[model samples]
Target chain A: MIKLQLPLTEADVRQLKVGDEVALSGIMVTGRDEAHTWLINDKPDNVRKLLEGSVIYHCGPVVSKTDGEWKFVAAGPTTSIREEPIQADVVKEYKLRGVIGKGGMGPKTLAGLKEFGAVYLHAIGGAATLLAKSVKKVTDVIKLEEFGVPEAMWILEVEDFPAVVTMDSHGNSLHTKIKADSDKIAKELIGN
Target chain B: MAFKLNKEKFRDAVLELIRLTSTELPRDVIAAMEKARDNEEPGSAAKSVLGSMLKNVVMAKADSTPICQDTGTNIHFVTIPEGISLRKVEQAIIEATQQATAEAYLRPNAVDSLTGKNTGDNTGVMAPYIHFEEWDDPAIKLQLALKGGGCENVSTQYKLPDTSLKAGRNLEGVYKCIIDAINKAQGLGCAPGVIGVGVGGDRATGMIMAKKQLFRKMGDSNPVQQLDDLEQKLLVDLNKLGIGPLGFGGKTTVLGVKIGAVHRLPASFFVSIAYMCWADRHHEMLFTESEVSYD
Candidate 1:
């Protein structure tokens, strides 16, 4: 397993292959549909300053506040395919080095990853509480009121946040390959 | 005669159900996950993935944190005693859902489709969706299922004889639909998954019934013998696809298969699948005039 720190270099992303298990450290940003739309439409300065060469985690975290500090109750990845509509543009525009999500993105996002030398990391979906442990602190939260809890872009300082590279910078996607393999076996089993 | 509801007690009951269901994985689901974990080759991604998932379940239960961040859409199927005001029950659930969201037992999930606005509280138009039916019995039964969006996105509905797969309109066709849906889901639906299938009914009811099937305990057989047999058979067939946990590929692709049938019009044959991720969060509560019990 590879251990990567955020603000990853293009060379760092290029070295990753599809199916490489990795643990990410340093600062990362969280976003979903609302934030994606906001990014593409507005290209906010705060986001560009924070997102350059960093990973964008597709997560809407469960958060609780205590004494004015926000703590993660549970934090897990949301489905990535929903972000496909704007992800390619977000990648190119943000100069993103890695995209962290589950369920994988579509062809457009994969092409964007290859073109921009980024990889799509698959976090374990439904492993929210476990994932929360890796989050060192909730450094900041962006657009909390506008996008709500799950859709808000949260800036997190993380340590050893685990994920697997399912879409690599080389234009390879484990998600696509898995689908094809499963489909072939399904056809044979069903005699189609 | 109608049984009067104690507003505070009912609200507490719903709140407790939400907290327990959100924080804990039911025992049967835990067992299935454990078995899947044990069946994998040591040090494989599937094994380690299932290991972390099982660990997450344990930590969530111990810490009283939500099992998954999404905490998902709260779907309630309620069977109330005759003459009870369902409107009151609905309001109580909605209120309890709000309380739960504030308390962080649930993530606020209800969103406005057109505006992309989240309700902030998990209660909005059609949020914490409740389906109510009156029963002759004296007790109220409530079943809640928390379906995460990742798995929900991959769920499929088919019009049989799916010509693309060459599946005809029969039990065999239903089998084909199940396998095909799993194949398409791959790791996307957060496999090892629980598949609840509804055969018959129109599109809407088919989906509702399919989701209802998930309320059945993980290993419980369908009351109908044929459906029971099909459920068991499909479980075996799906695991053969080798989709494995988190789609990394290994043994044990599916955790459970549940099938239900609804009466349908002669014109349409719809097969709907409610694909549940390994989280598989659900619980049931029974309430009477004096006491409330949960399982």
Candidate 2:
């Protein structure tokens, strides 16, 4: 597994392949539907600056407070396909180096990744508690009051956050391959 | 003498049920996952994902945290004795869900479909959706399932005898539809998955009954002989598709298959599937006048 740190360089992201496993460290931001919609509609300068050269995770975490400090109880990836409508634009506009999500994105996002030198990292879905262990601290939360908990942007400091690169800057997409392969297998099996 | 329900007791019961089901992967589900893990080739992505899922269950339980971040939509299936108050149960469930959300057993997941607004409390119109049934037994039974959005998105319904697939209106047709659905899902539904199938009924109830099939234990066979045979056969066939965990190619794509049938009009033959992720969290509670017990 390759290890990555925050503020990933274009060269760093470009080196990834479709099946490379990665363990990310440093700062990252969590966002989902509302955040995506907000980014596309307004493109806030401060948020863009914060996200510059950083990984964006498609996640809605279950967080709790203890001793007056917020902590993650569970944090896992939501489906990334929902962001396909805006991800390509966001990646290009923000100059993001990496996108971490689950289930992969569509063609538009793939094109954006190739154009902007970004990679789509696939986090394991449904493994929330295990994923939470990688988050070192909750640094800040943005748009909480506006988007509510799940859709809020959670800026986190993480160490060794694990994921796999399913879509890379080189135009390789594991999702596309798996979908076609599985379809062929299904057809063949059903024929018998 | 008429039995009276205590609102506080019911609310507490609901809250506890939510907490337990959210944090703890049911034993049956764990067993199936472990079997899938064992079945996969060593060092494969599918095996690694299953290993991670098993570890996730342990960590979630040990820390008293939610198994999946989504915590999903809370579906409550309520069976009450005649003369009991549905309003009281509904109120208690709503209250329990709010409390659970605050305590972090559930995420704030209920959104306004039209407005795209998050209710923030996990309760909105038709949220914590309830389905009612009347039973002769004196005890009130409530079954809760936490369904994550990814699997929910992949769940599909089919009107069979699909000519494109050469599927006829029979068990063979149902089998084709299920394979087609799984093929379309391709690890997107967080396979190895649990398939809950409703063989007949109108659209809504068909889906509901299909979801209800998820409550069955992983290895339990359908009571009906034909359905049982189909369930077994489909379980084998789906796992052979090689979708694996999270769509990473390997063996052990589907963990279980459950099928239930409901009465339908002659003109309609709908098969509804509720594709449940590996985090198949569900539990049941029985409330009597004096006490509440969980299964």
Candidate 3:
């Protein structure tokens, strides 16, 4: 039941722990597979400036434009593991305070969060349509005209978005904990 | 004989199916989650998470919106009857997919593998990869499945040896392979999901069968009693692992187990397992001239 305002400061991110329920409100940048590749390879100009101190969401939303105004149809969380190879680098380079996605990131991202003073937030995986309502406004978009709407970087203003802290700056990850516990149980059940 | 389907009607149906699927967690999935919530003995935390997931499904349905943001890559498994011309049907499907892509405002999931170019439209050269299986029946059955990359990423295939030991054909070897895949995947594929098993087929056939089996409705038993029993056994074994909803740890990890088998050559035994995430968007329809239908 923790209420958090996004574009979170380093100090604010430090206080969060794994398994904390958070309702976030602020500006978050949306990026999926493509944008991540660009950030990792090219280090696009002004990217750091755009995302600095902001939360990055691993998502590709379904959005419709009517009368030149864009509206979200379904903006659900994408699996965070896809970006694990580059997430830590992206967070450090951009000075990002948080990441919002479904599932969870790996050891590298968890370590990066600890080193960079950040947090990884897990949004409800299947609640795409409801999540869209939290996006108050679309600030801007980039690099997805040809890729269609999903791969675009949609800068958005959000309000009271919900998430759980699955990874913290202390190198604690909820995903790892759950998997270890599950595996132990699995091994016992299989009588190994 | 060639039957022409109205392109606009086809487009509308695909869009509607996507919309419906996005907003609602199918009945069986809901039931499985509810049962897991009740049966999970770990603690109140896991139960609470499952409870919210159920509530989220209800809200998504009530609002007529997508349950998750990842709408997934739209997959169409079209089976045409022998003697029917498929040119028009194929053309209609491609056109309908493009139109639905625009209408649903679906995220452009298709991308060039090598150059990293994203195809604006969801379709490209062999994009949907329609496999035409000639059936003896006069009617055509189309199964539409929207597969998210998370679950797709976890799909695995193993080529088993021909040697059989004392304890049967070594089916445990296949089970172990699948368990390893699920283990390596961790929570990435979205747990509390279904695993589509394709056994006893050629490599390509096994893979396709695994993918196609995902279109089967959740909770429906396999037509063959043996396969149905195996499915039940697999379900129980998978859930016992404690990789609950979203892999957060609980009693019910898999909603169901579906196995589709085809007799293969005596020399080889190939197994393919495809995983489907919680946002399982799929529907079946029978296309006939009398009345345009949707499931």
Q: Find the candidate with the highest DockQ and give its number.
A: 1
Tens-digit lDDT string for candidate 3 (B1-295):
5554555565556556555655666676777778778887755556766776777688778877666666677777878766666776677777766766676535666778886676766787777556676776556677777778778887777777523211124466566655655665666777777888888788888888888778777778799987787787778777777667777666767878788887788887887888888667777667654454656
lDDT of 1 by residue, B20-63 (tens): 99999999999989988998999888998999899999999999
lDDT of 1 by residue, A117-156 (tens): 9999999889999999999999999889877888788999
> What stretches of model 2 exceed 4 Å from their correct place?
A66-68
Query: What is the lDDT, from 0 to 100, of the residue A44 in candidate 1?
Result: 87
Q: Taking the candidates in order, what DockQ does each have? A: 0.79, 0.73, 0.55
TM-score winner between candidates 1 and 2: 2
lDDT score for candidate 3 against the true structure:
0.76
TM-score, candidate number 3 = 0.90
Q: Which whole-number lDDT from 0 to 100 does residue A14 have in model 3?
A: 95
Clashing residue pairs, backbone N/CA/C < 3 A, model 3 = A76-B69, A126-B67, A128-B67, B22-B66, B22-B67
Q: List runs of model 1 lying over 4 Å from the truth.
A: none
Give the per-residue lDDT digits (tens) of candidate 3, residues A6-38.
Answer: 667899999999888888888889988778888
TM-score of the A-chain for all models: 0.98, 0.97, 0.96
